[model samples]
Target: MGKKSATVVLAHGAWADTSSWGKVVVLLQSDGINAVTFRLPLTSLADDVTALDKVLALVDGPVVLVGHAYAGAVIAATHSAKVRALVYIAGLAPDQGETVADVFNRYEHDEKAPKLAPGDDGLMWLAPEAFGIAFAQHASPEEQKALAAKQLPISPAAITVPVERPLWKDVPAWYLLAQHDHMIPEKTQRFMAERMNAHISAYPVDHLPSVTAPELVATVIVDAVRFVDG
Candidate 1:
């Protein structure tokens, strides 16, 4: 077998903590791959970017920066030259001039998602009831409850703030489109992937495939590593 490849630093989505990637991390490590998950502060976009930057700096060699869900904006906004590739997993890959809010507004999605209202602390989060349907439909009931308990509230200001620099434009990109995702419509994902000119793969899964379908997610990530190596 070829030598073990570069380290992978995986970032989680809006409501999730680094534990969201638990299964994927286990699978990657079983193969002797070096991987780490960044525990994003889920505060402001700038703070999230800073956390990812710290993770990138810790990588010993070339790195494949992986982002899930909202973290696509996070990774693209704060990448370093040491990153060899990017893999967006059922995530939003916005451009430098675009904001996650702009991307969401452009797409006409079902409004079933719980209305997000800003909190006293200026952070926004999913309504407790919306968690089961919108965010954890694919996970087991226990998993859903666990995720709900640990969900982090983010600042609403972070959503509309466009990325200052999107790595998608500067680095090679791979997108894993979750076909069964109810949160991010497949149609919108296609549009974003096309706009970004990414190499795309389709998966018949929900938004958190890295949690519910770890093996499949790991394979997609491994494929991206191979593509970058070539």
Candidate 2:
């Protein structure tokens, strides 16, 4: 990809901040693809999308939005005309009238996956131990620890709210399926990808491929960028 190609804006999922995309950003930068990441307020879907819209407004050219986990829904809700393509990495793509919780709870839960509920704080928190187990089992123990420590609690309102017309319906999209993901089951990923008819790339990775397998994540995003900017 060229330096002036469609810039990639990586969006972090629930329980994560912008740092999750650091490694992927570095890899994309090495390829002369301008990749940037922004923080999503986990307060609510509207809040997160507004934050992403503000960031999208700052960029100067076409964009390929890459979202992981819950950010998938956040990215697809954008009204930005500059977004040409979308890349969903182990993401949750809830259709119009469907909430993130709808997609998440549609399939049977993996035994290792942590059961989630809003805590007394009114935000959903992933247990630190669950991070090493289901969130990123493929990641190194040290990496898992860091991920757990760096998470931002996602508000219950974020996932329970229904999304508007998803941009994926209008834009070309790509999906990276994490085959071994315990958090969001592989079947669900496949269902969402096929529903969107997105170009699919499957890997024997976990949910947090941006952290555990940055190279793989970056490759799929670069593919989207090439297609959109070609």
Candidate 3:
């Protein structure tokens, strides 16, 4: 298989939708790599994994699974055989018996990180004002506003649920660490990436590097595609 023959499935993190991967998808498509993104309901970890599994089933041949933020854990929980590689974009990779919250709270959060709280509906959202600075500081004012407007709230239960055997332990993996991320500390991202034995690509971007630095993000994903296809 070649890079163009492999499908790249992208999973967005919490407080984001498929649009989060818009730029990367465009780049991948332009390169003749089949790229697609799925919408995780942000309801629970299991549900998100199942949703990804469904997307995987729809894709033909080999796939490189790319995840961001919470979707990192969601992609790891998948047992799909079609997934040839796993790519983490400042994603959380929890080991078996560990919940996303466990890994998330392991490190001291950045002081500027937004204080997240679940509404009565049990969905957690980032503060609208914090979206620009904390999430995507590198993005333009118009892009930041669009991101805030289309943001999706994740359920609290999603973070608390323990993960199964992480796919990273079985499949080759790559991690793109956002150095300026306030939501998940850079130290934490390094820790998780090292534990997964992932190929690391560190950049001076914020949490939403897929939006802020899509070219860099696409380059990393394309590397993974080549690696897996070879």
What is the C-alpha local distance difference test score of each model? 0.82, 0.92, 0.91
TM-score of 2: 0.97
How far residue 198's Cα lies from its native spot in candidate 2, in Å, is 0.4
Over 20-109, each residue of candidate 2 has an lDDT whose tens digit, in order, gives: 899999999999899888888889999999999999999988999999999999999999999999999999999999999999988897
Q: How many pairs of residues in model 1 come into backbone collision?
A: 0
Ranking by TM-score: 2, 3, 1
After aligning candidate 1 to the native by TM-score, how far in Å is the CA of 142 from where it should be?
0.2
Question: lDDT for model 3, on a 0 to 1 scale?
Answer: 0.91
Candidate 1, residues 1-230: lDDT per residue as tens digits?
67447888899998888899999999888877788986888777888899999888877778888998888888888748888788888888777778887776567666655566787878887766666777767888889888888887777877878777687888888888888776788888888888788889988888788878888889888877776667
Question: Candidate 2: worst 10 consecutive residues by lDDT?
Answer: 1-10
Judged by lDDT, which candidate is best? 2
Worst 10 residues of 3 by lDDT: 1-10
All candidates: TM-score: 0.93, 0.97, 0.97
**Model 2 segments more than 4 A misplaced:** 1-4
Between prediction 1 and prediction 3, which has the larger lDDT? 3
lDDT (tens digit, per residue) of candidate 3 on 42-115: 89888898899999999989999999999999989888889989999999999999999999888999788988
Model 2 residue 92 distance off true place after TM-score fit, in angstroms: 0.6
